[model samples]
Target: MNWILLIIAGLFEVGFATCLGKAKEATGNSALFWMIGFFVCLSISMFLLYRATLTLPIGTAYAVWTGIGAVGTVLVGVFIFKEPATFWRIFFLTTLIGSIAGLKFVSN
Candidate 1:
């Protein structure tokens, strides 16, 4: 389904974001490797987003896509990158999750 593709695309968005973070922390060949991964993930994410948009409403799809990416990237930051998980961050994350789920339920 297009929604599934959109979700997958959102995941790839997370992958690219993670790769960027890793690339930033890396040097020499390691940085190059992560950069390559970033480009690959970016390409796949864009392709899936394009495919999903063929049927899904653009506004809804884009919002959901970015929502998923934002949520996933934040979690990744907290877990993988050792970023602080403050109270406000968690509170807003919960709301964002609710919004994403609400969009899914309200959408066709």
Candidate 2:
């Protein structure tokens, strides 16, 4: 259950990151809306992450959280923002996913 919460938190991290980018691109009321979304998601992500940490090791939980968020954000960039999906980017993303999996495997 803690792992599930951690994963959900990571997904929220991705959402907040995307909201931040949107907020940066927007202006006036649009920017305010995005900023509000960003704060909401950020708060939820942090809360879930804190809950997960009550049971999981801090270092491992943090790394996994960031890894999931990084991967999800990069994918969002490539798909939604039309960012380049270079070979090296995909390779390193795969490596990060592998490392995250390894961390989960090693954790009790």
Candidate 3:
């Protein structure tokens, strides 16, 4: 379904973001590889987002896509990058998830 594709696209958005973070930490060949990963993920994410927009409302799809990316990237930061998962961060994340789900529920 398009919604599924939208979710996958959102996940790829997270992939690109993670790649950027890794690329920043890397050097030389490693950094180049990470950048390559970033571009590849970016391409796939964009393509799938376009595809999902065929049937889904653009506003809802975009919001859900960015919401997924934001939630995923934040979790990645907390777990992989060891970034602090403060109370406010977690609270907002939960609200974002609820909003995304609500969009899906309300959409056609």
Candidate 4:
């Protein structure tokens, strides 16, 4: 359950980050809405992350959380924002995923 929570938190982290980026492009009331959504999601993600770390080691928990978020955010950036998705970018993302999996196994 803690691991599940951690994954959910990671997803929220991606959502908030994407919202923040979109908020920067927004104008007027819509911008405020997106900004608030970003902060709210960010706060919830942090809280869930804290809960997850209570059971999981900080190093493992943080690595997993940030890894998921980073990879997810990059994918969102490419798909949603139409950013470049070069071979090198995907190669690095795969490396990060592998490292996270290795760390989780070793830590366990």
What would the per-residue lDDT of candidate 4 be over residues 73-105, giving only the tens digit for each residue? 999999999999999999999999999889878
Error of 4 at 5 (Å): 0.8
lDDT of residue 6 for candidate 3:
100
Instruction: Residues 22-106, candidate 3: write the lDDT tens digits.
Output: 9999999999999999999999999999999999999999999999999999999999999999999999999999999999999
Colliding pairs, model 3? none
lDDT of each: 0.97, 0.98, 0.99, 0.94
Write model 1 residue lDDT over 11-46, tens digit each, in one string. 999999999999999999999999999999999999
TM-score of 4: 0.96
Candidate 3 at residue 21, lDDT? 100
lDDT of 2 by residue, 27-106 (tens): 99999999999999999999999999999999999999999999999999999889999999999999999999999999
What is candidate 3's TM-score against the reference? 0.99
Best by lDDT: 3
Residue pairs with backbone atoms closer than 3 Å in model 1 (clashes): none
Enumerate clash totals for all models, in the order shown.
0, 0, 0, 0
TM-scores vs. true structure, each candidate: 0.98, 0.98, 0.99, 0.96
Against the true structure, what is every candidate's RMSD?
0.5, 0.5, 0.4, 0.8
Which residue runs of candidate 1 sit more than 4 Å off their true CA positions?
Answer: none
Deviation in angstroms for 29 in model 3? 0.3
Arrange candidates, best lDDT first.
3, 2, 1, 4
